[model samples]
Target: MSGFSIVNGIAEITDPAIYENWLDNEEFKAAVAADSSPERNAVKRLLIDFEADLARMVRDDRVQEQVVEVMTKYAAWDYVQHDPNAAGNGLEKLIEHFRNVPVVGEVSPPVVSVILDGEVACLMMRKPVPDPVVPDTTYEWNILTVFRVHNGKLAEHWSTFRKAVPGRDPLGD
Candidate 1:
């Protein structure tokens, strides 16, 4: 069995081997379902809505202003530090980065998980890389984002990404 359990009303995924196996394991799935308290539900909903907005932006090539509207005025987007165009910083710069850059293909919806402890929520998701810029070659990426939500809006965000080697899968298998 996957070493997933609950203690003091918090879901604990003890086994690193089963970290990515929760989606398929019935026990883990049931545990996640049972731990969906009201606060967690709200954070989940917020992430879903944010993803929908991002998808819409990718599909239409237009910025959805309402998505940022829900964010705090001083929302700290840790992901943009790697973006060259975000030199000015802040949400507007991030929006400009998205607007100026060209998206070759659709953005796939990420697999999201949320963990809530008291007033803090940790949201984790895996997103696929966009299509390659070069022809006849494919380079894939797996991006994981963890967001800290406060007051029902995104307060802080952090992300890490891994690129698949050419002619190999993300895991280099």
Candidate 2:
């Protein structure tokens, strides 16, 4: 645990505003891209072209069209999904599932950081859920998502999501 970093602990904005555009954060991108290996580069591309773009798609509700192109480019159609709340485990399912979601324009979810370990890459994000006891107040939770790169495409995915009581704190705090 010596190397583990904490986010959303002191405040809701533990991550800097630049992280919201991580791909464009030159220093952050340079630090990660220093490796320059094939697999690492592929994972970086996937993060930028697919995952980063996902925010835009969500904001505009362009789930079906743009998401398809990027998902197809970076992720395997048959990729394994470990999150219990995930829609399904295929490219088509990803598109179909998001199409039904409501558009939230550039609310700028906090993407804390991303790290790579061989074939696996982890994207850390800070999510805020409404405080159950205090209306208009909220608390933050760290969400870690891991993606495994295979054959230069995202082959598997996992996340820190769990079922919580209705209108309650997601972490049951």
Candidate 3:
């Protein structure tokens, strides 16, 4: 249980209790303190809104509203494609893939690790899950999200996903 402090993009959580304390501290209250820029607050609100929407998704096993809004927000944006034509690249296509699945299992809570360099932030997350078709098939995969945030708005983003294979124990060799 940890989170981005965002003051300088430093994330620190020594204990589960620390994160619990943070939940009660209500960091959003701190975000609302400075009243000079309403627009900045709006972006902050958007971040919170997305976070809340993600929570709802966890409960519902869908990302409909959030996906639509995010796609609209990124309209006319440049996207780097690993394989643009194959499956997912555009927001609609991404949403389609997830929606197309007969049973959309809840995505695991992202294990977030951030790399901060100046104003840029890269969040490396590992989200593992059992293959829906075969419950016994489980694997932990990596998803990296790079965000360029300026003035508190998500100006740009890049993301990629990877998976790992399991190896048999040495005694079998």
Whole-model Cα lDDT per candidate? Answer: 0.48, 0.61, 0.42
Cα deviation of 68 in candidate 3 (Å)?
A: 1.9
Q: TM-score for each prediction?
A: 0.49, 0.65, 0.42
Model 3 ranges off by over 4 Å: 1-9, 14-52, 64-66, 73-86, 98-120, 124-144, 148-156, 163-173
Candidate 2 ranges beyond 4 A from true positions? 1-28, 31-38, 108-110, 127-141, 163-173
Candidates, ranked, lDDT = 2, 1, 3
Q: TM-score of model 1 relative to the true fold?
A: 0.49
Q: Please give the lDDT score for candidate 2.
A: 0.61
- Can you write out model 2's per-residue Cα lDDT over 1-33, one digit (the tens) per residue? 121233332122434454355535545444433
Please write out the lDDT profile of model 1 over residues 49-71, one tens digit for every residue: 56545655555555445335433
lDDT of 3 by residue, 1-173 (tens): 23433344333333434322332344532432223456544444444344334434534655554555644453223333342222445555644533432323333333234455654555544434566777788564554556555555455555553322222211111
Spell out the clash pairs found in candidate 1.
Answer: none
Top of the candidates by lDDT:
2
Q: Which ten residues in a row have the lowest lDDT in candidate 1?
A: 78-87
